[model samples]
Target: METGKSYFFVGIGGSGMMPLAMILAGRGAMVAGSDRSLDAGRVPAKFEALEKRGIRLFPQDGSGISDAQQVVVASAAVEDSVPDMVRACEVGATRMSRPELLSRLFNDSVRRIGVAGTSGKSTVTGMIGWIFDRAGRDPTVMNGAVMTNFADSQAPFASALVGEGDAFISEVDESDGSIALYNPTIAVLNNVSHDHKSMEELRTLFGDFVGRADAAVINTGDPESAAIAAGLDREMVLTFAVDRDANLTARNLKPEPFAISFDLYIAGDFRQTVRLSVPGRHNVENALAALGAALASSIPPPRAVPALESFTGLRRRFERVGEANGVAVIDDFGHNPEKIAATINTLHEFPGRLLLLFQPHGYGPLKVMRRELVAIFAQKLKRGDMLVLPDPVYQGGTVTRDVTSADIVADLAPAGIDARHIPDRDAAAAHLVASAKPGDRIVVMGARDDTLSLLAKRMLDDLNR
Candidate 1:
């Protein structure tokens, strides 16, 4: 992240790429990029916001990579056949992967906090960032999702906050094995589950991730995370849990529709009652993880716990779009089994039938977790609940389609779950809206796609009609 260095991101509008581009631009680096979404005329607001920041946007053609000194940054998903990459090679521009550059900047920071896991990474990172900001630490924070606490009219996408403090907080990804690149002073491991990689591989990656950190904050309730904690020195680990005894624990959880209240305990001593604006026991676990990171960073409980009270959460994690005609629509980033289960469990706490539209994030993920996805939907959806599936999101990548959304729907049928495979997302939304009752909750769940939020809003709008 050298000052005044020119960087061009191939997939500039992506969740991971957008924040890094903003951070680079904020730090005096000349930033510009291009996206296929921009070419397709999708999500114009996101491209408009980027252009407003003086980051030039171009079509996905080779026109964006003219300068030889301009460094081209791309995610692992970007194929070498992309015109930008080909043009970069033609122009002899330096090429760097997104994680490579991000890790470089993360490793350079004096005090780095890396939040990792299969689930709750974004929420926990947002919580830690909000706490540090409220404490006046002026920390620079990077996250995959927009932090609603920092989002406003000027900066609608506040995924990255650039500050002058010594702390640099970011969520490190293990799905791509890039978690090894980060070296954190304080590391937070929420939980491990089957998402992108095998449990054995995830364990090895997570174990080494915390191994590099000076202090690790782990969730004892998760068996995989607890196993990792078992091998670490007790003095170097700060453990948190809701169902198990740990260094930090939450007791007497009171779940609400959109918020939750719980008693915070530290080492068996009662501390204070914590009321989080975000709902779900998963969030209660997330809160404990963030507080553990803050504690490991030497921030007092009085200062850190109170900031979570004001934390409004991320944009797509169970974000309520609107309520119309007694039916509520929620937009969620619940692509994996664990995240989907958490969302279902939290919503089921109240008395409402759930009409779910779960678009698989990718064809590859469907192939990887076909059985797990089917099992989660069958186990979580009650007899009266309805489920709809759109085709997995495909953005011009070559992938095997052996396991499609139809397979998932077929699998759910044996369990007496009412599920349908509506290949078109618009038709899926229509089904969700048409089937939604007065006391039902219409939930749009998926990841890797920004249009899901817009779909949720449209469902609410149709319900209003």
Candidate 2:
């Protein structure tokens, strides 16, 4: 962290890796990195953003690790199997995990706040960042998603902010065991669901995460999170909820397509009634989490309210990609049952023939949540709605052979929700556009793949054409 230290990242284009790279490069460090897949060339937007600030990109051929003193940073994904990793060991280079580097920087800061959750991590992270940003805390914030608040000619996504203030706030990941690395002043856990790893592992990781924090904010509605809140070191835990009693809660709940308005109640006394720009009960839950996190971090209720109001929602979270011929195209990252149900449930609020085009993230997740996916679509999808499935995304990694989106479709089609398996995404998009009526909504859903958003936009463009 001292001035001018050369840092080489193994998997630099990852959402987590990109923000850290930009932060370090912005700090006047010599940063360079590599990735295995560069097909879309979209990662260049990330590295080029860093390159604009003087960082360079190289192939993962060990050239970036040439300097023995270089700090080689990478994620758990970057194993000793990779050449850069082997080179780092060969050259006696100081190696670090992405989270470890982030923790080193976070711990060095005078103040730090971390947000951790399974579902609302990005949205909550964006909310906390906005609250502090508007309060003139000018805190350095690292987020997984594009925060539209700080978009300007210089930084569009605003994933990493260079704040003048001492507070260093970030959204830490418990799913990947990175949350264990962060020692934060405040930790926010929105809710823990099945995303990565098992509940036993997540419990240990998230429990340790909140234990290290000066204060831990949790969602009492989720049994897992509530248990974690109860288990954490006493007097440091702050709870937020919509139903069950907690330290800070959002009561008098309401939901709408345009926004969700609710009354905020902290401990016992009545707080301010606020309206979230985003829709859904899930977002209402997200607001409570953000509200609690910001309040525990000492952000004034007045300041946090306006920041939350001005928030424009995250990209691909029930995002309206485009509309053509009266049919709306929506793009969302809802590969899991909880996420998928949330999106479809929101769509049900508005009047339309819901046409869903879903591609599972991977074979492993498809197998893990196979029954849940079937139930989500079967339960939420109306008789007026129809679902189309494409094959799980494959990038030549080892995957379960038995798992496929088609299997889920077969399971759901029998339930009579108008389910069909269309393996090719392009064909599925075309089919959706062709079959969609004047009042139909085409929702493109999946995660771990950026092409879902692009495909959603393309589907709209094709429909309009």
Strongest candidate by lDDT:
1
Candidate 1: tens digits of C-alpha lDDT, residues 11-77 = 9999999999999988989898999889998889998988888899888898988889999999777
Report lDDT (CA) for all predictions.
0.94, 0.81
- The estimated TM-scores of all candidates read 0.99, 0.92
Models, CA RMSD each: 0.8, 2.3
lDDT (tens digit, per residue) of candidate 2 on 355-441: 998888878778878877888888898888888898887754355669777788778867888888888889988888899899898
Q: What is the lDDT of candidate 2?
A: 0.81
- Per TM-score, the best of the predicted structures is 1
After superposing candidate 1, which stretches have Cα over 4 Å from the reference?
none
